[model samples]
Target: MDRWVGKTAVVTGASSGIGSGIAVGFANAGINVIGLARRTEPIEVLKSQVTGSGSITAHHCDVSSAEDVAATFKWINETFGCVHILVNNAGIFVTGGITDAGDDMISENDIIAILDTNLKGTILCARHAIASMRSNNFDGHVININSIAGHYVPMSSKFNVYTSSKYGVTGFTAGLLNELADHKNKIKVTSVSPGLVNTSLNVVAATTTDMPALRPKDIADACLYVLSTPPTVNINELTITPVTERRL
Candidate 1:
C-alpha cells in the first residue's frame, strides 16, 4: 500500500537490524525516511538499497542521550518540514544473571545505562515528536519496539535490566496511548513486542542454545501494517514470535 506516499518518517537505530528494515520498508512504500543512529555507515548502505526514488536522510545521533535526540529531531523537523511517523527502535541488550554474573554482567551501571537508553531515550524521542506534531498541527504516531521479555519472564539467562526497561517501554506506550486518545483520532501510540529476533543485540557468545528467531524484516512488516491502518484504527499492541517456541 502507498499509505506512506509523500509522508515523512523518522526511524531510530536505523543503522541496522529492525531499524534499517523499517527505514527501507518505508522508503519502498514511497515515504521519505529519516534514518537516525550513532553510526552513519549502515544508514548509507540502507539508503542505497531503497527501491524507489523516495529519499533517505541519515543522521548521526545517540538515542540514549537527550541532547543528541533533541538536536536530531530539530534537524529532522527543519529538514523534512513534518514528521508523520516515528519508530522508536533504538535499544541495547546486556544479559546476565543478577547474582552470578561478574561486573560486566548487568551491573548497577549497566542497569542505569539500559534504562537510560531504552526507557528514557524512548521518552525523549516521543516528547520531541509530540511537541513537533502539536506545533505543526499534524497528527502522527509513536511506535516503540518492545520485546516478549517485557511481558513474560524468560526461561533463559538473566536479563534484569533489559526486562525492566522493556516493561517500562510497554507501560509508557500504554500511558501515551491513553493520553493521545483524548485527541479524538489525531495522535496514536503503540508498542510491538517480538520474541528472539536474530540481531546483534542477542549476544550469541553469552547465550546458550540457538533457537528459531524472527528476522528484522518481520518486525518491519508489522510496523508498516500498523502505519498503513486508517487514523480511526489504533493497534495498541502487537507481539511477533516464532511458532516453534512454545512459550507465548
Candidate 2:
C-alpha cells in the first residue's frame, strides 16, 4: 500500500457492485484511481463521496468496445502518464441456456454480448494497460475479477454462456502469465475467483440462500491483500468461497 501511494490504478465496471468496492478500497489506500464504466453517473457520485489522500476520476467506457477502451486509455495516459495497476472487473449476465430451443434459447446477440464483455473486454483492457506499463518501464499488476464458474461450471442451468466466458478468463489469465514469464516481464497477473457474492451479479442466489454468501467488500479485501504482496511474488489464482458454499 505504501509503495502504491500517489500511483495510478484503473478499475473497470466501477459504477457498481464489486468494481465499485475495489475502486473505493484502492483509493482509500492512497492510490489515484481511474474508474471506468458504461454508466458514469454512479462513478461520478462516488468521486464526490470518496474521502482519503487519493481520489477517483470517473471515465465513461464500454469495455466491449475497442474504440471506447482505446480512447479511455489514451485519456488516462494523457492525464496520469502510467498505469501501475489494472482491475478487469466488468461483466454481465442474461438468462438463457445453451440447449434451449425457440423462444427459450439464448439469442445470438446475447451470446456475443457475454463473450465480448466478459472475455474480449478483459483482453482489450489488459492489452492496453500492459502497453502503458511497458512504455513507461513500470512494473505493473493486473487482477482479473473472475468467478468460481471460471474454474468449474455449477450445476445450475441459468448460467448458459456466462460460464463459458468465465472459463475463457481462466485460460486467458494463465496464457498471459506464461507470455509475461517468457519475456521476463516484471508485470504480475492474478485471478481472484470468488463463490456466490452478494452483488447484483448474484442477487437471486443471495436472497434465496440461507447459507453464507460473500459481499462486494469481501472481494475488495481479497484483492487488496493480493496487491499488497511483494513485487517478486505473484499470486497465480485465489478462489474464495463462503463457508456454506457447496461448490468445489
- Give each model a TM-score: 0.92, 0.96
Give me the candidate number with maximum lDDT. Answer: 2
Q: Positional deviation of 31 in candidate 1, in angstroms?
A: 1.2
Model 1, stretches more than 4 Å misplaced?
1-3, 100-104, 183-185, 204-210
Q: For model 1, how does the per-residue alpha-carbon lDDT over 146-245 read when each residue is reduced to its tens digit?
A: 9988888766655667888999999999888877777664787889999878788866422546567888889988988888789688899999987786
Candidate 2 structure quality by residue, lDDT tens digits, 1-248:
78898999999999999999988888888888999999988987776656778889889999999999999999999989999999999999887667655356788999999999999999999999999999999999999999999988887777889999999999999999999999999899999999888878884484466757888889889988998899889999999998878863
- For candidate 1, the TM-score is 0.92
Q: Number of clashes in every candidate structure?
A: 0, 0
What clash pairs does model 2 have? none
Runs of candidate 2 with Cα error greater than 4 angstroms are 101-103, 203-207
Cα shift from native, residue 59, model 2 (Å): 0.4
lDDT of 2 at 144: 98
